[model samples]
Target: MSEAGKANKARSGGRSGGRAARRTLRTTRDFRMLPGLTRNIPYCEVMDEAHVERLDNASMNILENVGVHFRDPIALEDWKTAGAKVVGERVFLDRGLVRELIRTIPAEFTYHARNPANNVRLGGPHSIFVPMTGAPFLRDLDNVRRNPMLEDLATFHKLAHMLPALHSTAHHIVEPYDHPISQRHLRITYSSMMHSDKMFMGMTTSPKNAEDVMEMCAILFGEDYLEDHPVTTGNCNGNSPLVWDETMLGAMRAFCRRNQPVLCSPFVLGGANTPASVPAAVAQLNAEALSALAYTQVIRKGCPAIYGHYLSTVSMRSGAPMAGTPEIGLMNFMIGQMARHYGVPWRTSGSLGGAKTFDAQAGYESASTLSAVIHAGANYIWHAAGWNEAGMHCSIAKFVVDAVQCAMAHRLGEGPKWDDFDQALSAVPDVGPGGHYLGHPHTQENFQSAFFMPELFDNNSIEQWVADGEKEITERALNHARNLLSEYQQPMLDVARDEALRDYIARREREIPAASELNQSY
Candidate 1:
């Protein structure tokens, strides 16, 4: 055999043997959290039969009582004919319609990322999806004030590129421009064309722009390619404290017709949007279900979708949504359980600690929130990192820190393996009452085998800390970020492809000189 063929055979054999060994080590273990601690509903104990019943009841109550308002006349009329009560702009959906809509949605679908590297398989028996960041900057890091503009499309792209946990990157923030709506759509187009190889989609405030962006993406990838690949997608945010409006619904429908996936995000703020209590939160979630599910069904039956629930506690004094609160963690857990009840895929935000610096508070909060989601078995997890100061600002430092936390979660999810277990047990046989296993062969084998996070907290002695000038977590993280950026090789866009992409961007820029100039200046 040729040398290359022999090498290939050896490599293939190694990989196959390794996988078989890992599989053999697997054991039945329940990684999910206890029922009450994880979700508002008794998901773990109730079994699939009872869970489905609860979901049905919840959907019924939402449709009959907490009707969603639709400003669009056509949509309102459609709902009215479908047994929904139309009170002027409001459409009260009944339980039957909700169930019908739920049935229309597909149980599983694939989300293609920028490249093959970004593509993710979503919706199965049990799976997990993680994203790097959430909505763009709501806070100003320098001034320490509410500054949404701090997060731009470019920043979003960069964050997406950096985040390993995030399966798909999102337009995390709003940008500043004269025509904010048009500019937002342009940004999505530019980012999708330039940054992602997989599925990339978002929604602007304007329905018209949303449709335009989707069209542009179709043109770029070709209509036939989009029908099959569906890389670019859109998000529909149901206004919390209320319901989805005409524009959002229209945008979602338009995209869905083109085979684009729509993420139905219901931003429910506890205490403000609903009641402060958990039950009230669940009730609000039911209302969200009615609205978001109806929109999905309205667009096209069985369209690719996600049950997105972003619930946070509101501070009475500040009127700001308190991220990383215990309430947020509980809500994420409950939402996952609810999604499981429906036998549909779920997506939820996480690791959003309302901290200004990359300190202990940031680490602890991120870890806690992420742990909840992992334990909940959420299929699609957003905001795995890159949130701080109540979802206001984007912290480069915190992003890296949260990434380490995400890695930790993935490791924990692996559970205990028997191969190592036997070795560990065998080595510990001689250890008794006062004896230690530190010197054992098993200890040596497993000690450093587990993933360990680099310390952001000061772990050195006083003398060493003082000598190192008492550097903070932010300093350490900043250094780490610099190293990563410096080491980052532009992922393989070959010469021909690179030239084609550049020319395309350049042509677009020339057509809109003013916007191009503005981007350059920024």
Candidate 2:
């Protein structure tokens, strides 16, 4: 058994103490982490076959005629060697080449985790939830918004680890502002490794940082294991308006060469980054993503990659990016269709909101976005928790609530269980037409699995709620988070390997330039 498996087994086998100890044990028994879901339901398509074909033709036209900018000289040369028409930085691709290149990508790939049991498959009907990343500020336990510290980042990592619905502890849950930018990636990668045994994202701020992450992975999973298995993911977002810059290209090359999966995502703000029309914006994003995905094959043919984008509509009146808007949901449906049309796994944003607090607006907007992604058949759901204030702040209270919502959505994605229809109908006969089934034998046998009873939501009577202090959803979620943290047990790692990782971090910290000396922003 793995060290993490043995440790978790020993913890679960602890002897009980007094009544208080028994209560603590019962409260913290929520450590059942479900594996990545295999969705049985059909995808929700917003466009007809004709519409999808039209969008693909438009994307192909953009790639062939208009062309995309390849800012990296190496990328330009690769295209030039591949018979693409390269004019300086712009590379005009033939429709057949792009199609043939992407055909080599695997439809599904297993993302290995430290504990083998945590490994998740990406592509096909598989889906996994990952927490929000890149938030700069945090709405902490006390509900005060401020710049996050290293401690705050580690806290979110632990929360993500304990949350059963969350499958990956996506690196940099929030920016560790207190740390130096030059070395923050090192600490972020370390925290993710130490806090959770799940698969995580690699540091892609710079190619050097990305290489450092790969080395650390080698130390943890062994150099030989990494050569055959993909353990970490790298997210490379295109600098939109049909451009792939050097920074992102470098990161993609670093991970692709190592046989790791890269998410070729475009950060799209409608009207600002692309045309305001939803179809036009999707065509542009699809073209940009295809360009990057095709480039990954150029870096290493058969390298795992995901079709991804962050879609948000702009408020013309306020000039702010709008989350959970109808346009955003429409874009998600269209993107899912395109990804399926091209036979590739795709990713979409999750539970995003613009509310400053975990209020009605936050709940409504998050629900709107979550429902859309669940129905849209997104394979990898990012920002599944704690996203608020238009990606400005990550909220602790919101994080807990959003995780529960993810659990509900996960159940929805699995579709209905018709295998028990006969047994369910037996209850109908057991009780007369006008009778109740509360006491039926079938109800007694299957009541627990029949319905998804959410632990965080309160459906009690008003008097009972008031008698129990009448706490709101935010307070309940905060309390649940506290309980989960109090019971968190660190996953085990090899003592020698742990030391080696720390030594590598310390050595790199001394070698890397200081934040002031660095020329690029992370």
Candidate 3:
């Protein structure tokens, strides 16, 4: 055989053998936290000390001068007791007190899951990834995108359990149109409990929904255990232009008083809800985030809170909101810096795309934004995978592709390991000049982990590619998704605990009117 032919054979054969050895890695791979690069290496920093100070002051000014409106009378009263000046519904905070309250937040906290093995540690040095939370539609391999059915939601939870890339299956993976409105939370929580054992978000639609999820969680983990240890979180979204509506505040109150974490995030699209400028938008984001997070502490001190940022710009031509844009990347880094400055963990997003289908546009936009946020030091990443059409739809093909990327990103975040430097150095001398180190001891020892294995991406020579019929990555990913579903086994839950959950759901269902009744009542 020619020398080139021998090299190609060695490469292909060795990798194939590695795959066989690690076949079980896909099913049992339990790396939950995708770590960030070693702190010794500087990460991307957009703002210097002076810029950070300016931004901090800008946010504080908004809090002190403009203030935020709290529509809920109870929330307004709570803030008033915390020494904020309350003018009707709007509450203006004293910056000194706000600074003091923000300092009370812990640097790190543990979020226990239904299955103890899948519990997650937020803040500190770890970077955790979660799936897309709220998508109204679903797209499967047939390539038909439509409103999600009840079964689709359960399937997503199962997929999250099978794929180790996902640390948790987010609540409401996709809204189930088939279920009744009043009882959707019961089914959503039950679906997650049945299919996934990981930590998840709770319902924030209303205080009652939040209570229902907590009651179910208590059934799984004794009520006493859950009170001291947080198991689920609630996403408390702040209305743009400095407003805190009643429903979200009620949810936050429910989660906070119980010692569960709540992500205080603001949804801002520049040139619409917020100003066109990045600095202004970030300042506004901080102000809103601080207001809501401070409210959590007031409800109960030392409640776990994450500084969440979800900022995107509106397209000038069509007024459509864009994700994973250059402007978004720049603002994300700054927000991360601010989060760290306040000694709080940051909750950011990734795998966000504007493409309608799982294609090139999805690949580029999703990967770019996800990487940028990870490198910027986001702690809790939602919408980590399966997000398509600017968060309008979720795709299984995209989910599989992003799962592979999540593992790869974590490997990169660990930075270079030199634990075996002396051994590697000795092997270099064994292979003298003009000789390939294909058979060197160091190469043999490090080969398995030296490269990030592509789960769906095909890396082949042009000749080999041509012989394989040149399939698109999405088609390959679809095959992997199908295989995952076919082979997945539900993780075992204790029979009594499962029975308790079923009983809770059964009783709640009786209280909720049927779909026909729901339609008439509304």
Off by over 4 Å in 3: 1-41, 514-522
TM-score per candidate: 0.76, 0.93, 0.92
- Best-performing candidate as measured by TM-score: 2
RMSD of 3: 3.4
TM-score ranking, high to low? 2, 3, 1
Candidate 2: stretches off by over 4 Å = 1-28, 516-522
lDDT of 2 by residue, 1-522 (tens): 999776555444432322223243343265657789888888889999999999999999999999999999989999988889999899999999999999988899899998898999989899999999999899988888999999999999999999999998999989998878889889999999999998899989887778888889989998888767999989999988999988889988989998998899999999999998999999999999999999999999998899989888889999999888999999999999999999899999999999989999999999999999988999999999999999999999999889989999989989999988987887776777545554556755665567887888986557869998999998998888888888899999889999999999999888877764363443
lDDT of all predictions = 0.61, 0.89, 0.82
What would the per-residue lDDT of candidate 3 be over residues 27-123, giving only the tens digit for each residue?
A: 5444343333232234688999999999999999999999999999999888878999999999998889888888878778887887777777788
Looking at candidate 1, the ten consecutive residues that score lowest on lDDT are: 30-39
Q: How would you encode candidate 1's per-residue C-alpha lDDT over 140-161 as one tens digit per residue?
A: 2232334344234454455456
Clash pairs, model 2 backbone: none
Error of 2 at 35 (Å): 1.3
User: In model 3, what lDDT does residue 158 have?
Assistant: 83
Query: TM-score for model 1?
Result: 0.76
